[model samples]
Target: MKKVIEKKVYNTETATLIAEYWNGLGEDDFMYCEEYLYRTRKGSYFLRGSGGPLTKYSESNENQTWGISTIIPISKEEAYEWLEANDKTEAIEEYFSNDIDEA
Candidate 1:
């Protein structure tokens, strides 16, 4: 399965959209995706997931310091596509199987 990396939002509306999308997928189908909510300085939010690269690029970038505040199960493909459509290419990468949890 292809994975999308990350998404950043500054408001609740976007966060709601993410939640809605996850809920729409149905619980039985959630194994295909993973979603996480992160907070940076000043309350900024980040929505990220596992799938692509084994190496987390953010660990080498400024976002390495960002704190993950929550985690949820969502469609990995959907998140990846959204990132691609929105031109968030920097959020996508190749990841190793061991880096992700099978759950």
Candidate 2:
């Protein structure tokens, strides 16, 4: 199934932070797409919101980074709808919540 990703991200710096964090750790388990940033762990994964076409970077002499030309063109409402339809928020919450038995 086509992954439904959120439109609203926590901050504009999130993408950069993620890229930098991954770079710092020297990992290559993430893929940047027009919809969302996909990170895989043990063959499973999750998506996070980020600038789509506008979230790329050019080749730089200082550090190697992704070149996000644009972000996923969407709004907050659309993002929420996608989340609800995919039931991702619930799954994520259930996974992270302290009250695992309650859920």
Give Cα-based local distance difference scores for all models.
0.36, 0.35
- RMSD values, in order shown: 15.9, 12.9
* Candidate 2 error regions (>4 Å): 1-34, 37-70, 91-103
Clashing pairs in 1: 4-80, 52-94, 52-95, 53-93, 53-94, 53-95, 54-94, 54-95, 54-96
lDDT per residue for candidate 1 within 1-103, as digits (tens), equals: 1122365334433343322122233333323234444333443334554321222211235543321223333345545555555544344443113333444
- Encode model 2's per-residue lDDT on 1-103: one tens digit a residue: 2332464333333222111112221122234332343323222233343322223422335555444333333443444444455555563353334433453
Cα TM-score per model: 0.23, 0.24
